[model samples]
Target: MKGLFNLGPVFGYFFRKNDPNRTSNFNLRTMHFINKLSMAMFLVGFLVLLYRWFLR
Candidate 1:
């Protein structure tokens, strides 16, 4: 999983639509939505665990 961090640009490429003039399609929107949701869920779960650990 250490190599995953190095692939930031690779995953970033798919997350963004290079053509600004092009209309947003379902696939593109779905990819972005899933990316955002996963990040949010990870962040929230991390914060909860972090605070719980601190209290222990």
Candidate 2:
């Protein structure tokens, strides 16, 4: 956990200052994609539950 905290600054620095022309890392892109998908799924699930409750 402490190591992650230490790397926070490093990641932040590169995230801000990295070159756009260079090919970025796949790992970060994949994580972001999954995060967005999970969020969308969660919202859809919540809406379904609400609709069921209203129908009840």
Candidate 3:
């Protein structure tokens, strides 16, 4: 239950080197790329929302 609040793994995902054992393919690569993009967009939106909330 405690792991849910931990952010180490989330940041680790962006910083860690690629696993050599994992198979590289087009679909997998595209999925990972999109996943990263969505996460980034969500974070940005959350920050903007906070900024607007504080200004009000």
Candidate 4:
């Protein structure tokens, strides 16, 4: 659990700091947007699967 929470900052440090595009800030907002978008896609796919399962 501790490692899971720590992973983001560690990754962000690399992606935002080490990457060539350093103009962007390294913080939680970017991470949150990414997470939300990914979760939304997963939810949409899950709902589609459930609808298909019911049709069968």
Q: Which predicted model would earn the best TM-score?
A: 3
- Global lDDT of each candidate: 0.78, 0.70, 0.87, 0.68
- Model 1 agreement with the true structure over 1-56: per-residue lDDT tens digits: 88766957745755765688878889988987898788868768988999999987
* Top candidate, metric lDDT: 3
lDDT of 1: 0.78
**TM-score ranking, high to low:** 3, 1, 2, 4
Can you write out model 2's per-residue Cα lDDT over 1-56, one digit (the tens) per residue?
76754755534543565568967689987876686678668768989999999987
Cα-based TM-score, every candidate:
0.59, 0.56, 0.83, 0.49
Question: Lowest summed-lDDT stretch of 10 residues in model 4?
Answer: 10-19
Instruction: Flag clash pairs in model 4.
Output: none
Q: Kindly report which residue pairs in candidate 2 clash with one another.
A: none
Predicted candidate 2: what Cα RMSD to the true structure? 9.0
C-alpha RMSD of each candidate structure in angstroms: 4.2, 9.0, 1.7, 9.4
